[model samples]
Target: METQSMLVVPVGEETEFNVYVSTQWPTLIQEAVAETLDIQSSRVTCHVKRLGGAFGGKVIKTSILASITSVAAWKTNRAVRCVLERGEDMLITGGRHPVLGKYKVGFMTDGRIVAADFHYYANAGCFVDESVLISEKILLHLDNAYNIPNLRGFSVACRTNLPSNTAFRGFGVPQGVLVVENMINDVAMALGCPADQIREINMYTGPSVTHYKFEFSPDNLQRCWEECKLKSEYGIRREAVDQFNQHNRWKKRGISIIPIKYGIAFAEGFLNQAAALVHIYKDGSVLVSHGGTEMGQGIHTKMQQIASRELHIPTTKIYISETSTNTVPNTCPSAASFGTDANGMAVKNACEILYQRLEPIRLKNPTGSWESWVKEAFFEKISLSSTGFYRGHDLYMDWDKMKGQPYSYFTFGVCCSEVELDCLTGDYRTVRTDIVVDIGRSLNPSVDIGQIEGAFTQGLGLYTLEELKYSPTGLLYTRGPSQYKIPAVCDMPLQFNVYLLSDSNNPHAIYSSKGIGEPTLFLGSSIFFAIKDAVAAARSDSGLMGPFTFDSPATPERACLACSSPFIQKIPASQPGSFTAWALDI
Candidate 1:
């Protein structure tokens, strides 16, 4: 309940509902709208040129809005467009789930977590939209990157009056990861050592199994931690932080390094399929249409690269079509950080089929240009169009048993954050952040790095700045930008460094590239731990020598109270069920 008063609401962009209905399934916007409106699917044509920014907000809600618009259009016999203002959008659309977690962990003196019992209650709003799946994800990811032997966890999707909470970047993984990280921090505080030491001691390096019984292969968990530690000079910085804390009374410095091993696939299992259509013209130009929608994640760019590489054609010669159900049927949402993995492989498959068709022609004329080869294939009446369907081959999960591989692979990364906290004001600034990620032969370093930076910054906002508030009667109070705070450029780390792991490749993915989206967002937990470290320093200065627990957003008020000895004294030691008191004794 410590975080209840923080009242931090999710600060996502206000995405408007925009759709055009025409007679169709191959078009982008019409199929889902048509189905929802109970109209002939072929009679509805949907055109989705592009999204402003979805971040998982537009997947289902857009369909809901489009259905409403279609009905209006049908009834009025005129065009209908519904756009919610910023305030209206905030009130109507769901954001990330507000989670409440209670956990008990038993760790050794060296800070190795041996067992954990955790329960997470997610505010699913008024409906069961994605909350059940989100809960499953939380349970699966409770261990984060650690290998805990005896762990039992479950989640409850509480129905509330608020709008239904939908998916964000990391889905529900961030909230789950936060709980385990907090426990690790508590353990470190209890053992009087750096949090990083405990993290390293318990990381999944060798053969390990999750609570759900999915086993891990030898992975880059240790590599990422060690590389981040060396690259960030964590040892040197810890010394500096200690010296700085000793010299300063009101301002304290703290550093923390956190690692993540996020699984890559849809938890639902059935949504792990994609289709792509490829067309090759006589002029050697190629067009690709895939089931995955592009919401500013560079998926199209990656697909283009995949097609170009697979066909041995220049990327400039490839054009990616807008996502439409007519082109690729029964598509999955572009989520779970599998946009590139699912769609890219489908495109690769389509291109490979084209290559096989043209192989005999190329063998006949060994030195022909690509255009000439395409014309020859046309003359030979070989099919120049191919549609590829790909279902993730080995993905299986028994939800009742909660035992199977839900993810095709796992993405690994580490983040080290340095923050300076002002005890007087509870204000904090990110001094610097160094990140080392295993992108597994990054398809495009620039695009992947941009995603890493953006996701990390958004996660930082979630943990430290953004706070959604509501009235007692269930009305949104922080409904607009003026009331909701998002991290700006000024809030960025004064110094930032990001690196992609080389010499690592995903054997299971197309071009051996791993997912780069959601994994890095979990890295933002480092900042939260860093803030906690500063608060711990302040408490140490005040001669309080046990673990300290502070809810997130770590607002100036919370930081000030965490540092105040008078505040600690005022808290009754005998108070039952007091988390603060319990933390002090732990």
Candidate 2:
């Protein structure tokens, strides 16, 4: 659910407004507000103190709030503030698109995918918004972490009356990845081998090209898998789970490992630029402003660190200003996990210019205090302020042709999940999870780990507990916390271990660090596969053969249906409402 809570207040009777919105694309909101109010773009000021959480919802929707509030202020001739309650917010804001996918895959007996064809329909709701872009992203990620020789994918944005679905963390990539991962699981079941083995056999290697024709170099996909396997003791745990399932008829244990290779950068190449302004005061203190927003992702912290490192100044001497269009104009939204890579480079460029200005003063007074040198530079009327801009070079994509390098690089990861399932109740618990992620010389280990954990948790909720339901008339029923269930603290695995691949680095990014925001969410699919493994165990115990197929969420009811044999009769039509009660008899 990519929804955000926002507050907007007009400044005064003047056409200008002091708009406070929680959004990643504040400049876009500012421009929209100005245009809506028939005022110059300069009259609209958007101040984003910080966002509690955005995922991706706060970008375009915040502009709508800004426009409404500005109009209200104009009509009333007074300041107006609008803050939506949670229920209202949920009803109005969009979430991840509910996609219906149809896929046909051809595989060998050894579990290698020879070809795949996928047709995806995204529920775009009432408005187009970003649905077309999201659909393109879904097509781009249909291959997920594997390499298939022949692949064809197409996507459609299906318009409905509900609120328009917008971007989530991974945008539409997760939906596409889920389809392929599910197919791989089916292939593994048919081959009578673990899904991880199939994934390994199909994993991309040297000189491989994606469906979009992006060539790959050596990546950490295999490395992360091997490291995660060793750390999780996957083989030993599988043996133990088999033994437990053999002895325990009512309870079964299952384990699965999955890998992910997510491309970084916006598929739309124009959004790959960033700007930063750095001001050095006479007192040797610096203030840095960048286009990236801070949604608890530590992007501001990384910008400050970049400026400090580049200027050869202590971090304490640097302060990050609020993200404002007045300071850094025509900015791209902080998204696609490129916030650090893009903004960090811009800040670095600004700091380098400032450094050049101070170099002469430093050489003249090499032993002087830092403050004295800054004072000398200030006295000489040297420009202590500099604006830096960076555009990602050599990044090109042809949407019409749908071929070229859409990403600067890729982020890779692997996850292993172990689960215990109750055959009678269809209840399950995640026993353990192991993860190895390649963050490419992590800018900040703590922040990267936090992102990985948070994204994984959200993804787990999406697949296991976060079920969004709607009424017949297009009303959302799961509009509140009570109706919608997200993963709680207890839902975390009992034994969880996460490791960063230290030897990896992205040659194309700032500080050689890859984006860590959305890739780990794909790892959460491991839990779903693990649950499927448990259901397969139950099916095998009942003398059922062949592949087991079930829908998402693997809810208790769905799990029970997957476990029961074909001969096991379900509740009759008269007692259909009591299906769960009778399902225990299986």
Cα lDDT of model 1 by residue, 222-249, tens digit: 7888898899999999999999999998
Q: What lDDT score goes with residue 117 in model 1?
A: 94
lDDT of 2 by residue, 1-586 (tens): 3345444455555666777778899889888988887888887777777788888888788788868877887777666767777788888877898888888989998888999999999999899989998898888888888889899999999998888888889988887898889889888888898787898899888777888888886467878988999999999999999999889877888898988888899877789899999998988999998899999999988887898789887899999869887888888998998889889889989999999989999999999887888999989999999999888755677867868898988898899999998887788899999999999898889988999999999888877777777765667778788988889998899998999997886889998899989889978888888888898998998888777667777777778778884434465344666544411210
RMSD in angstroms between candidate 2 and the native structure over all alpha carbons: 3.2
The models' CA-based lDDT, in order, is 0.79, 0.84
Per-model TM-score versus the true fold:
0.91, 0.95
